[model samples]
Target: MAEGLFRFAAADLDDVEVSSAGIAAYGGDRVSPETLQILNERGVGLEGFRSRMVDEGIIQQATHIFCMTRSHLETLEALYPQACEKLYLVCEFAEIDGEVGRDVPDPIGGGRGAYEQVAACLDQAIAGIIGFLRGTGKGQAG
Candidate 1:
């Protein structure tokens, strides 16, 4: 969801490469129906997205790595301590002041309402991410 939202938010910026993966994912897994439906309702197409696991190669290549929860950050930190400097909580990097904390609650295993809430949070964070990327020149003007 965050990947799709970031892609949608950065649609105008051609130079950025935005993607997301799960720490425990198996390659080629489809996104959850809840995620698909929510993004679809928002007019963000995640059609070719297949779940992939975060590997050393992916981590090494990423200029920035945003985790949805502190646990995710810790897992990555444990696996690749050398890359810890670039790892950050999504909310922290988004700099959403007064956000319920750095963690974006996992909406998995819930119903539509849970998905909706997660989507709203993603929308807010994605907007802030776009702004931060642009200000830093990491995302070039189209």
Candidate 2:
């Protein structure tokens, strides 16, 4: 979800700062071949891409933060209450019911179809987020 969402969300929010991180993402793992192929076909750049972990500074510095699931939102809150108000579950803004949807399901070890499914969901979520940010008059992505 991070991989695919970054592609669309980054472009949508090109006006706003955009970046993705894992709670414990591996550092510099070459993006999976299937992922690269999928995003590339969509014309999203895969160059200069590398994975990294979500750290305190990231949560601290972000004006608004988005996570893939409720667990992630909870984790972020547990670690930093000061940043909680700014955090959101990517699906939340879209009214997708993430707690019951569980997760977007990591498509990493899967095949092309799995990645595509993940990408689609992320694209919708990103659209919702972009709209939400715009509505709040928090017009700047911070």
Model 2 regions more than 4 Å off: 1-15, 95-102, 138-142
Model 1: CA > 4 A from native: 94-97, 139-142
> Which pairs clash inside model 1?
none
**Consecutive 10-residue window with the lowest summed lDDT within model 1:** 133-142
How well does each candidate superpose onto the true structure, as a TM-score?
Answer: 0.88, 0.82
lDDT of 1 by residue, 1-142 (tens): 8888888888888778888888987899887899998889889999888988888888888887888889999999999999887887777645444663367878878888888888878777777767667777663211
Tens digits of lDDT, candidate 2, 16-107: 66767777679786678877887788877766778888887777667878777778878888988888888877766664444423456678
RMSD vs true structure, all candidates: 3.0, 2.9
Best by lDDT: 1
* Each model's lDDT: 0.79, 0.69
